[model samples]
Target: MATSESANSVSQVPENCRAPNNPILKLAFKILCIIAVSRESLDHWKDTKNKDWKEHVSIMVNRFQNTNVTAGLVLATTTLFLSSPPPVEHLMAYNSTISYIIAMISFDAALLSVISGSAVLVIYETSTAHKDMETLKHMPRYQVIALLLWLAWPSICLSVATCFLFVAIFIACFGSDNIVVNIITILACVAFLSNGALTLYVFAVVGKKPANGKKNTPTQVIDMHHASIGAACLPR
Candidate 1:
């Protein structure tokens, strides 16, 4: 009776715990196990890649924090300039109103861009904080759009703000009664133009380098997995 009960209990064990009897079933189970193991390995690889991507994004966040601080200063300066305009009678008549209007519009646009970019970046960072694997793999349409706006919009708007600010300053200063200030402003403008020209020349010269004089085919799409290799090749 004991032997029979023990045998019956063994036969009643769960199908998953028991080895398969048929050769085909055994082969199928082996394949499933292999697939499961491969999937786990692939997930491990993806996790490593995700960590690297996060590090890159963290660096970006730090740089953007500095940019945002600079933009904040610009906003403050713009606000002060807008609020403390010269008295109506004292205002210069050389298209001063038009320049002020341009500066005001540019400043407002820049503020809006900065706010929107920050909000989008926050949302993107929050949503991907836990799981960026899917984001990296699928690259959803909305994510792409958000990423583009976050990366480009604020900087472009800030550039416009600075340009308009300088333009307004130049117009106002040129109309001023102080000869020394006018001469200094003129020299500053010349320096600015020369620096911009030199920057462009340097960029043009530096962009022509190839690997050991063998022209590398420009890759259309950059793979995050290969980003480390490319970074390693960069000058320290």
Candidate 2:
């Protein structure tokens, strides 16, 4: 009777309860799964950010190259014109107001083109992988590139403005009688003004972060609070 009662009691026990899984092992496995998932997510996020960084750097490099080319062309053309003088009868009076204005335009345009080309070359050199990695050790590479690009924009705009001014000066001095020249001069003036405005806007707006009415992130707030407490505890 005792053997039968023991067999009945054993049978009454739930299958799950009879051989339950180890709670500690189950918990450890769950934790490991969470960690693995977290790690994969972090890796994916890093890859995405790196891709974006590379794309941005490529765009900045292309823009710098284009600017440098434009500046070089302008500089070359100006140099050629200065090297070859026309017959005295065909040339405007060297001492005349128009001549002086032309001289000023040429000087300014050449100077701006040289400066812009040099700056763009420097930026390109600095943005190379080795240099960028070195710079990244101190600060984010993207921020460094962003700042350099911001500086380059003004130079680019100035170079363009110089080109427009060169055309306008030419039209004013030599093409005054032609209606087409008058229209072109007006267009050049408009382009110059637009370039100046864009430069100003870039300086004022592009790098600035938007001020959304939001509080600091939890991590930042906690860090700040801890810093404040630590400061308070320090001996004055």
Candidate 3:
């Protein structure tokens, strides 16, 4: 009976009186609440960023697959041509051996870079896919930058290989005495250079990402809506 009475007394305590009367206790409680809320917010932000990152990675994977296929084709063609024995006259021609060597080396390097980069990307994605976002959040800034640059290596290497291949072809053509080959090579080089310039402009200007990397977040959108409503309410 005494225990029952005590329980009843505790349950019947006034709501206002239930709270700690000590100022320090109240302040500490408030601080703890703030900390809990901040932690939740940080986790939520990380989750959102994780989703965005995964989406970006998926896009990169698709591009890498395409590049792999294209590189494989180029590599195969170069390997087949290089495997065959060249005629003695052609082998002895000025710059012919050097040009062939450069072309072979460049194509091999390009293929290797693409394959290695893609493998690293796949391994990273597989490892991180099931992991907590906290791990990624704590990753060093320089490491993240390095990973981004590594993702870009395949494209850069491929571009350099292609340019070298073209250089090799130009060298071979110019060394020949045939006027037809010379004229055709010159025209092709002009077109290739123009296309390269256009590609640079497109990549540098049109395809540039935003500096701040801020997308249309919910708070920003809500603020914009409120501002528009406020402007509408004001005198014209």
Tens digits of per-residue lDDT for model 3 on 1-236?
85798566545543322324578855543333222221111223244344665675566566767666766766775565566553533322323678788778767767775686578558656755766644544556455335445655666566666777677767777666777777888898999989989976874676455687556789999999999999999997
Q: Which stretches of candidate 3 lie over 4 Å from their true place?
A: 1-52, 85-95, 204-236
Q: Please, what is the whole-model Cα lDDT of each candidate in the order they appear?
A: 0.58, 0.51, 0.60
Misplaced by over 4 Å in model 1 are: 1-51, 86-95, 140-146, 207-236
The reply for model 2, stretches above 4 Å from the true place, is 1-49, 85-123, 132-164, 167-171, 174-184, 187-236
- Kindly report which residue pairs in candidate 3 clash with one another: none
Candidate 1 C-alpha error for residue 33, in Å: 42
Ranking by lDDT: 3, 1, 2
Global Cα lDDT for candidate 1: 0.58
lDDT of 1 by residue, 1-236 (tens): 85798666555543333335688855544433222221111122233354665675565566556556666777787776787756532333234686678669667866965785576567646765765444343454345334444555556667677777777767776776767767977997898789989976985686575556655455622464478778889998
Better by TM-score, candidate 3 or 2: 3
Model 1 residue 87 lDDT score: 50
What CA RMSD would you report for each candidate?
20.4, 24.5, 18.4
Higher lDDT: candidate 1 or 2?
1
Q: Which ten-residue region of model 1 has the weakest summed lDDT? A: 36-45
Error of 1 at 100 (Å): 1.3
